[model samples]
Target: MTEQNVDLGKNPRANRIPWPPLLLIASIAAGALATWVWPLPWPGINDGPAHGVGLGFGVAGIALIVWAIITLRKRGTTFLPDGTATSLVTSGPFARFRNPIYLGDALIVLSIAEITHSIWFVAAALLFGILVTALQIVPEERHLESQFGDAYLDYKSRTRRWI
Candidate 1:
């Protein structure tokens, strides 16, 4: 039997942000701000119908987070800012989208905004996600391409960046 090995170079820009730690901090900050500044309205204090809509958004956001986590775990992947992969995963949720984590994060943010009925926050989150993806995600893709080459390229071609 013969084994073929492929070399994927080390990513120069990997682990840029210490993402897990940063994510924790950001989550705390966001939660604090939301609590201090724009706390959820007390039930019966606002329009009844709109409450249902808001709750739906909140639920959707939670659902997306759960789905994203499951996908990552099943694929043996992480959402770290750095683009490092133990293996090329082209199955499960990844088969449908190139960046399920990003999509899920965006959905959660948008859902929170909608739930809060904060147009300003919704727009801000959308812009933030776009910028983060551009600055962080795109470069990571470049690194993946450098490493995985044609396989990554084929995956890129087949999967949508955000869907």
Candidate 2:
């Protein structure tokens, strides 16, 4: 079998273990722990306004995930870790943001930070977000560029990294 075929058969590291998803899970766990252990000073109104905002961000993040899934399904594509794209997706949320899911995740993290009113937590979230984007998304884009050529270039030119 060819190397590509071998790659397809073997469970690649990226496919088997996705760091971004894992990081996000870890961040959420840490945030929840901080909420219980560190217990930030709650706002005057305990009607859970902060919680509501955090929930809103969570909802947005979920929506973005759905958007990404829909786009991938519609295009019959997969953004595999091995830098493979069966098709290009330029519709739906992809039309607006090149990395909507990442942005949504960042927003969710930021909201959690706000809800907890922990500067340290906020900083941690921001740093984690930046690291994930740089390490994960940037490389994915490079792969996409290599795969799609000028079409990908034009798409990159038109779409913002985050919106």
Per-model C-alpha lDDT, please?
Answer: 0.59, 0.66
Q: What's the true lDDT of residue 20 in model 2?
A: 74
Candidate maximizing lDDT: 2
lDDT tens digits by residue: candidate 1, 48-157: 67667666655765665567566566666554666465455666556777666655555566555555555544544566566666666688678777666777788889
**Model 2 steric clash total:** 0
Decoy 2 TM-score against native: 0.73
lDDT for each residue of candidate 2 in 1-163, tens digit (9 for 90 to 100) = 0011212222222223455767777777777777777776645344577668777887887888778877776666664434456555778888888877777777777776666665445655776677777677777776666556677788889999887
lDDT of 2 at 79: 47
Candidate 1 runs further than 4 Å off: 1-5, 12-15, 18-53
